[model samples]
Target chain A: MAASGEEVRNMQVILKDYVAGFPKESDMNVKTGSIKLKLAEDESSDSAVLVKNLYLSCDPYMRGRMTNSPVDDPDFSPFTPGSPIVGHGVAENLRNSSKFTLLMCPFPYYTGILGMPGMTAYFGFYQVCSPKKGERVYISAASGAVGQLVGQFAKLMGCYVVGSAGSKEKVELLKSKFGFDDAFNYKEEHDLVAALKRYFPEGIDIYFENVGGKMLDAVLLNMRFHGRIAACGMISQYNLQQPEGIQNITTVVFKRIRLEGFIIFDYFDQYPKFLDFVLPYIREGKIVYVEDITEGLERGPSALIGLFSGRNVGKQVVKVTNE
Target chain B: MAASGEEVRNMQVILKDYVAGFPKESDMNVKTGSIKLKLAEDESSDSAVLVKNLYLSCDPYMRGRMTNSPVDDPDFSPFTPGSPIVGHGVAENLRNSSKFTLLMCPFPYYTGILGMPGMTAYFGFYQVCSPKKGERVYISAASGAVGQLVGQFAKLMGCYVVGSAGSKEKVELLKSKFGFDDAFNYKEEHDLVAALKRYFPEGIDIYFENVGGKMLDAVLLNMRFHGRIAACGMISQYNLQQPEGIQNITTVVFKRIRLEGFIIFDYFDQYPKFLDFVLPYIREGKIVYVEDITEGLERGPSALIGLFSGRNVGKQVVKVTNE
Candidate 1:
């Protein structure tokens, strides 16, 4: 740990203003601020832990928070202008100032597989979809943080999994690395409904929805009887001023399909339980995570903005410090 | 019973062709045909029962069957040109022919409170919505067959029930006859979302969706946290070539709402249990059903077509025979 009276430069990516339409790199600015290494005399010792954020997670749902209204989630406050944007990050404990030292021990894994995205995939796939052995699962945005984990988890459960991504590299990674049964570049498909029908001839039983809009509309057309859709996020619709309308939603009635939307905040209590289920897979090399990481905090604005354009191949992470 | 050799004139309604947009009265033609009163020699006594049709039900969902694809439901076959349209009806058994006489004993109640609409309201409200006592419930198409029953059932469950109709008379009937806590003529409301907010300031806990399109979009904005939406039918979209898109569907995620669609065919096994729960309510006049009877089967075409324009006052029924 640094000396008690030492001063440190804290670099952060701050929001310029409330974003409209697609977010541009210029919407964020990297600013330098100073912080004292030592705790104040009056500060509570048992409640707080000093952390040096090492890896900042760049996720699609963060785009929703950039907007002034944060229209999709009423509980989420918008990013304050000229302030450091808050998000999930892998942080290293600098000082033990809390009684719950055990809780702070796992801070390193808080941005990746054992973090918000991991819990999202766990609760979304197992709890929401209720997958059975040999059931067919289809995932959108499958090369991203949550999707990659969902695909691997589904495979571990002995289910057939197919994924759709935006680029050829991501598609190849899904099949070659993640062990997906089939993978497709959704950008190349002229007709998404036809593409989904071609891939899932028997129809999809469980759909892990990440990218919404046209994808959701097509998935609705290809759902099997009593199919379940775990609506984790709608990254495709988040940037649009007026989100696309779903035309074939009536199929929900005929197929007896259940489409439910969820956020990871509600499933935080299941973190310990999720780790128990996933740790073995990670340790045995049965599960793998690919991250698209950029060096230095200066590249944070572009790294975060690149998510909307499908520029990142895997989990986009901004590496702030080596320690 | 009529003599064995007697030939009776059976008035039938036949579709001219698969309808495109709105169905017109001319799309269906009423014609008279003759049927032998007695069963054929090859017809098994245990397999068939002869009955006289008394009342024919005219429902909004039938509009879906008028299309070429009937994309919503594959089980429902489109009306074949020059063939009599088949639907749920009140019938009187003339001959015992079958050993299962007890099952056919209640045929008279098949077109009203004990039939399709009854089970729809029962399962959609009780099973899907899972309403709690003192919760706020809202019903669309309030004066229609299933809607009226749903309103009454919610009231019986000790819920604060409100309903929306298309006309002043229907709105009055919802509040006075059906005992809805409050009623509104939606056609008079300039802004549906504002109107719903005015009625349900605390937000709606259950929304029995009978009409889709703009109403559904508006309802999404007014739903309370963890609200349940029983998508019984989308009457507004049935006749249109393109169904209206719902813009505020992401609210499902923010509010943690569960929107479920159901058809009564899936709940037939629960019919006996439904009867046990509902029969007493009807006996004591705790539940009352209103029928808009159009005399003669010749009026069936006009009565069925009238559903699109909100022409029928209640459960539109064609009184084909008195006895």
Candidate 2:
């Protein structure tokens, strides 16, 4: 068999080494591997698609999988030594097999907005938070994929939406681009509890928790009686050996607060419902989508690692191939 | 105005100093005090009741109130220096005011059961946990005031009930007296999680979390999908500088668990509803009530401190008067 360029091969970024504290650029390396593009014709195996990876989503959860461990981590599984590092990514059908099939979606910009980042925000806000009209909603890490969508959804529901981001640029995007009721740069704010009180003097009813640790503790103090906290992610404490100490756990009982953590996979069955709700917003320009794309599959390692450092402003995506 | 020879002065315990670490017996002291038996008709307060306490219930939460700077505390208010230690106690109405008229009940024991601990278990289980019939229920610190009642109520609801206690005596009491399906001495069990798994191989549906820290972390691993955890008390962590780190918080999302905390004061309106349910159990002897009474007002401080050390088995009560 002659080795051709188009031959079936598994292209992946392997974990060169385990990470401690902050993961550097050199921790990951892109390497080429091989895989069967075709599947067995046995009736037991269903049709599957061999996808050429397009837009890859860079998220905080990826950092958790970078560590080497003897025991399985409760948060996420440890990354294999010599496998393609997998995160949520948009792809096109390179080859169709018995088990899976794929699609070639709209333009490049539309890919990420319709991809993992968009889906995460769409379902996370509606289903997990269960927002209502005239409710007060707060979003932490507001300019990110899930936060940006959550803020917009809250606004669509006729809610008073306030957001907190790490940088002033992201804060401006939250207000100008996303049309949030109010936005603040958490880095600039001396006290988070005071900041929340300034924006929401009446008290916050629903909180989309994106950054856990001290922020969560402060939010607990500011929550109104019977407040709902949809804990989407904890970017701040994901890579730490020990996450931040929670002092305000008692507030859950006293103020009757409900804090719930969620994953988008649970609500994947409701994808059609999500598309039905969000597609119109995208079409009507009601929902503005933003993407920070780092070009090339070789850059996948850095893009994923950059999530913890607040490098990408909006939805962080690595452009694997221009389908 | 002449004092009777047989009349013993109202001697009560006071917070001698602010607690630093685990509260010591010397942190609180008994002080002899006097009060007027009668008040004038034009008294400033009408709703106040002058009651001679017959029985005082020693509770774990009292330890939390002993500190001076409990401003951040979510549950009960902190105790003031030089003041009589106020807690859940059965008292006789020696003098009546409109505010305290609620204490004038036909059966005083009814108030104790229906007042705080009874209501704690009622709302904590039903409202917080939202327990369904036949769901597997596990209670920690069983044979205590709230735990025993929770186990009994769960059993009545046709749920599989298991409880954990520190002593063999309490374990026997939980199984035979309280009608629990199984009970274990946590002190005797080398592995808490393994012990729980042995009793509940199918996994726990509802865990009434009384003792937090390691116990809570263990139960998190054993919880079934969509499990409910009523965070009633983290008695183990109350006195410590820092509570134990729960490494299994990731299970909260994976298992779709609902962890909620609640106080009894919120369920005060349900007192009548609680009595209607519990009175029959008391009369039919379906519910077993145990009281460990320490005689004399001087011993009250010791009784209160004993709760943290697990020195008292059942509802630890101090007998202040013969009546």
| Chain A alone, TM-score per model | 0.92, 0.87
Candidate 1 docking DockQ: 0.68
Worst 10 residues of 2 chain B by lDDT: B97-106
lDDT of 2 by residue, A19-62 (tens): 88788778877877676544334423434444567667777767
lDDT of 1 by residue, B48-159 (tens): 5577787788877787778777444555667777788878887656665332333433443567678889999999999999999999999999899899999999998999
Off by over 4 Å in 1: A2-5, A37-47, A70-75, A97-109, B3-5, B38-47, B70-74, B96-109
- The DockQ value obtained for model 2 is 0.32
**iRMS values for every prediction:** 1.1, 2.6
Q: What's the lDDT for all of these models?
A: 0.85, 0.76
Provide the TM-score, chain A, model 1: 0.92
Task: Tell me how far the alpha carbon of residue A246 in candidate 2 is from the true structure, in angstroms, after superposition.
Answer: 3.2
- Name model 2 segments beyond 4 Å from true: A1-10, A15-27, A32-53, A63-80, A93-123, A130-136, A158-160, A187-204, B1-13, B16-18, B24-34, B37-52, B70-75, B92-108, B188-203, B241-250
Q: lDDT of candidate 2 vs native? A: 0.76
